[model samples]
Target: MTAPRASIGALSSAEFLPQRVSLLYRLSGNDVPAILLTSAIAAFALWGYISDKLLAAWLIWLVLASLVRFVLKRAYRLRQPGPEAAARWEGFFCLASAFVGTAWGVTVMLLYPEHGQFHEILLPFLIGSVAMGLPPALAPSPKSFACLIVPIFTPLIGLLFTQGGAFNTSAGILILVFSAVLLALYLSSNRALIETLRFGRENERLLEQVKEAKDRLDLALQAANILIWDWDARRTNVFLGGNWAIILRVGKETSALNLDELAQMVHPDDLPKVKQALDNCLNGGESEYVAEHRVKTLAGGWVWSLSRGRVVERDAGGRALRVTGVNVDIDDRKRAEVELLAAVQREKELSEMKSKFVSTASHEFRTPLATMLSSAELLEHYSESLSPAEKANLLQTIQGGAKRMSEMIDDVLTLGRAESGVLKLNLGPANLRELCSTVVSEFRIAQGKQHVITLDDRFDRPDVIMDERLLRHILNNLLSNAVKYSPPGSEVTFSVSRRNEQAAIEIQDRGIGIPLEDQPRMFESFHRASNVENRPGTGLGLAIVKKAVELHGGEISLTSAVGSGTRFTVMIPLRPVKQPAGVS
Candidate 1:
């Protein structure tokens, strides 16, 4: 019977009591380590109630609760878990609360039946109910009211049984009124708690959503390669995202900058100009700000950025407090512009070269053609008086010169057709064997008895779809090259075969082959191999060959080496075209 130390707060007796209530609540539904405390409370309440020292029983229960709380605080530190794990623990907390609630109700009924302070039970029951109801408030689970409602109803039933006709009618009426008041308080308290928790939970959810949306927006800006910046028009304070620092290769340390520090970072040549532009934007003259400047980088290099901004918000005084914008690295675009300008200039020069080429070619062609025509006309008039040898020489000279002029005209025409994309191919079936034979025959007549031109025994295709005129040109070019480049006694041979539904024609010659270094550009317009300096060509032959082959959906390849022979293989599809209606 030592008086308890002064209670901690307004309800000192109750103050000590709440801890025991809380412990019993915590241990009831949970796997709390073997708590002998709740069991002790039950035994002591029952013993003290029978002994009739109501104060002693309540005090004993309170002391045990306080001791258990102290130990729980010491043993289980209330450190926050990682986000996901904490959510699971919240549910456990609720379930544990429900079990603790039922146990506390049972213990209160068994212990201290004479205290009749039904209100004393409200603390543990409310806590357990709330625990069961409001778990994972910030987490993703449903709140359940069953724990609160069940514990609430259980206490009422216990109250009814406790006051069951044991007292006089007046005393009984007083007990019933007290119980009703406790029930009302409990209901009101729970409603208040639930409303507060709901508001807090909704606020947290909104904050989380806002944070996620901001994160997604930041990611999108980075993906678009944009840099963000903000400025206070009145104070002229600048805020820039980390990407802005990255673009300039600058370390983004925080600094209290006035105007001078900012101006120092800009290139000396651009500083004044940029300041003026910023001033103009701040004056509300324009909603947007655009400027180009160079900034010194931490890496000791200068980078160019195209900065664009706009006034985001302004004070009532019309002073802009916030401006937001982006800065873009435009160095590549600037360099490309310079290169494009240079390319345009080069094109102008190439156009001049074309003019010269046309003028010179026309003059050269007119001289030979005019001589051939004059010679022919004079011969027609004076042929009877002329000696046979003189007439024959004149006729031969006229023919040779006319052929040269014709070849030059054809070259000019070919170049024009190729450049303008006007080259046409009339595709039809041609006999591969016959085409090869015809090419070899022409070469033989052109070469006379100097060199041998032969078709290999391998020539075998029955027919192939191709433009007959283009194929004739391809064959003529290959054979003529072989005849012109081969040594006096060297043999030029043509071969044909089929593989995988396509036809291939090969021309092999014992001629000076192309050099390795010049092969890449060999099919480029106006390009000629170094080894072919002694040959006469317009440098359009192989380029035309490549273009024509591609147009036919086929390809050509050349295998050659210096001082060795060359092999030109032209592979064409079996069907180069499909005829439209009425075509035969």
Candidate 2:
């Protein structure tokens, strides 16, 4: 995870020698000559007493060298040492050093003509060696050797042709032979050194490749979260690593792996599919065998794994001899898939239920609503001729039908609010005992002798906070359903109580109760049980009650069994209905 550090020693692998050496490395061409002049001055300071004329001659060469080197340094615009750009600058340094040594050799040959032949040749040899030892891209191998050879051989040619001092025929032959021998030695040594450098560079390159490959493999194994496996189908041997045991929940016993052991982990339902995939791989009928299946864990849980692989080698019969692959944990992905499918199925069911509700509501509400409207029109026309009793009964018939129609319309609106998630609440202070008594009184008048109703006001009436309209709708639905389903003269009780910060109301009915199977879906929109078919009801009544109670921050629950009485309880937060002092 840490970043690789740049090599500081790459630029200065050789120890610091002197400013002259550093300058010689940084500059190129004639700039190198200036460093040589500085170096010559330093050398002469140590050996100046040897001869005055020799020192003066050296000084003259130094002045010429310094002037040439200054111009070349300016033209090259050389860089200094740093990590960001060490290689490029250091390479230039090597080139400059090569040129410096060459220039110095040239200066020595030109000035000291009387020096022995061996000495004259020594200068050129050192120049050539410096060039060959550095990076070869700068001052090429053949060129540096050729240049040095020219200077060394020039003296030999002079000794052979000139009729002056130290130039007899025999001496000329010896000089020529010496030059040839030195050239031969330089060539052989140059070849040998180049071979050694080539071998070293090849080994370093191979080592780097191997290191990089190992790093990649290690990272892949660690980060992939997959169990890598290899199977030799012909040999009946398999290899697996990368935490297969942990994925299978084998309690840290991942090391012992065989065909039978692997089979034991597979789920009974998925074993056939896994066996088929393996059979195909072994028979040479398939190059790839991949499957997603469940495998039972040691703790009785199950894991979903995606196994994928391809034939790594084939035998003479074309059957797979080896296959390499991986098994990836896919339990989370499988669970998400199942959840998505269930959600889609539920959505389909809900859509169908909504359609059925619309159909039933249109048919059932139209008839009663039409009858109420017609009765109202007829009653207005016959008002003058009708007896007092006749008038009252007709008026009551119209009112009752109209009220029922209104309740059905309210149920539809409440369902819409529940679905849209925009049901509004208007919270205010209201008395719990007064609220229950009022609901019971209305239901008693509505039901007449068909149901006997009682109100139980047991809770503290210090007031509770609730949305008045929504709470009324909730109580109305429960009381109406009780009245509709009860036998003639059955008792329906309304009770109110307070607990902690909330108030609860219960509407209990002695009626044919809900079956156990239907209880779970009683509050779903448009859901009605089969036994309640002839009850003259829209199933939206209880659903609307649930939504209305929830809108006022309440919960509604039903407890019932077939043939027993049913109880519907509504609980709302008291904070919404708490009455102020001096208020009813």
* Candidate number of the best lDDT: 2
Candidate 2 per-residue C-alpha lDDT over 484-552 given as tens digits, one digit per residue, 9 for 90 to 100: 777789998988887776787888988888888999999888888767866777788888778778777
Q: For residues 1-584, what per-residue lDDT tens digits would candidate 1 score against the true structure?
A: 23333332223223223232333334432322223444345445555324344334444434443354345434334543444444344445445435544544555455534445443443343233223323222112112234433553466455646566644334435445644654455445544444555676688899999989878876776566577776775665676663655555666754345567667778899887887888889889877888998877777667777888988888889887887788777766777988999999879766865765666566666777787888898799998998999898888979898788787678668767867889987777777778777778877887899888778746455666788877878888778777777789898878887877777878899888888998887776556678776466656677777777877788899999888888999988787445669979
Overall local distance difference test of candidate 1: 0.64
Deviation in angstroms for 398 in model 2? 3.2
Please give each candidate's TM-score.
Answer: 0.47, 0.58
The pairs that clash in candidate 1 are 20-65, 29-100
Off by over 4 Å in 1: 1-209, 212-216, 219-223, 226-400, 411-425, 487-489, 498-502, 575-584
For model 1, give the 10-residue run with minimal summed lDDT.
135-144
Clashes of 1: 2
| Reference-based TM-score, model 1 | 0.47
Candidate 2, residue 110: how far the Cα is off, in Å: 26
